[model samples]
Target: MMVNDKSIVWILKIYLLIIFVFIFMPIITSVVFSFNSDRFPSLPLGHFTWNWYDKVYYDSETWDAIRTSIIVALSASVLATIIGFCTAYTDFRYSFRFKNAYLALALLPPTIPLIILALAMLAWFSKLGISGQIWALIIAHTVLGAPFAMAIIRLRLQQMDKDLESAAWNLGASEWATMRHVIIPFALPSIISALCLTMAVSFDEFAIAWFVSGLNKSVPVVILEILQGNVDPQINAIGSFVFATTMTLVVIAQLFLFTKKPNNH
Candidate 1:
């Protein structure tokens, strides 16, 4: 039995490694080709060159997309995190009818198909006369990102002691005061994690942005436009930059999540 278990463990490790490689190989290829002097990706990569990166740096359209993505990401992440915190705190501190239904709706956006969600957002924004605007993309991304923020913060809240808030109230602290001094402090790490995660989500999202962002394009939308034309080496460079950025944010979020210390309160 011990030998069998060891063999199984080894098999699982190999399987996991393969899965990671499969998922990341294309991204790795894109990064590698971004630095290759050759326009076409092939064996025996040409001499390393920074030309593609330089081109991406100077491309006005690319800069515009990057700036739009940054603005949308920042705005959406802040809005999403605020909404997520409120939803999570309500779930934690309140007991009301239809609570489960509320949670289901809160967490539903990510489960819906992106194309369907995009179409819905476009139509809704059009009705509101906000279609084809940067705000439209920002609003759409906020909706898409809020659920993720909620999930992360909710997990942190679940680990908190129920008596903590009660103890604060039993003292002289008002509801707002207790929340500010106790709950927010305890959940601060998770809040930061949620912000980073939601920003990453908004930064990488494409379909909805493409639908609602008629004139103001995000990075992913721009990538799609480039792809529609021809095989541009700039695509590889842009993809590499995006991959790096999202990965960095995700890594930071994970670190905060895992390294969060238990509140002494």
Candidate 2:
């Protein structure tokens, strides 16, 4: 039997709605729990309260975890963005030996299952005597985050106007000058997107951080540590804050992308 176009459209809409609902269910629950006055996150809904959030704000340990997470995420994201931009720029602007091989290798890190990647990182860092070090977490996150940054920036670089840089060079601009004057401004949106994504990745990183963390913990690692003991609504509270900020940045990155799109019009 053949389906009508309207029927297909309705089915597709329903399917998408179902998918989105499933995707957001955990987030919705977490947000709800964050506001719950209950000691633990469970049903028999407790009185509505913002007490958990207040705790999250005032708790010194929470702040410490946040600080550690911010430091690692910022460091990793910046390193990733730099390396990603350089590799992407090279792939787009020049042809070199083993170019395809190198691109494949660049993409390889993200392809590894993160659990496996974390274990592999542990082994690698152990050989270098860096296991259980804070920098080890940063390095592992950089490895994962850079591939995503490279993927985003690479696509943006490909979509950029080829003539602009050439025009700058034709006008006697140095390569650095052309990059600064013509390319960087054009690629700014993609750069922002890459940085935001890497920041989120680094912030949420768990397996690698669990493996490589010394005395310090990323926010996710801290949460995991807390989970081992009594489960608290504060976990949900802090989680809500974490989710809000990271997702907000992701949304902003997406908006910036809309502004820098290739003029297909």
Number of the top lDDT candidate: 1
For residues 1-265, what per-residue lDDT tens digits would candidate 1 score against the true structure?
9999999999999999999999999999999999999978898999999999999999999999999999999999999999999999999999999999999999999999999999999999999999999999999999999999999999999999999999999998999999999999999999999999999999999999999999999999999999999888899999999999999999989988987585566
- List the RMSD of every prediction in angstroms: 1.7, 2.7
lDDT of 2 by residue, 26-97 (tens): 999999988888886678999999898887888888898899889989999999998999989999899989
> Which sections of candidate 1 miss by over 4 Å?
1-3, 262-265
lDDT of each: 0.95, 0.87
lDDT of 1: 0.95
How accurate locally is residue 244 in candidate 2, as Cα lDDT from 0 to 100?
90
**For this target, which candidate reaches the highest TM-score against the unseen true structure?**
1
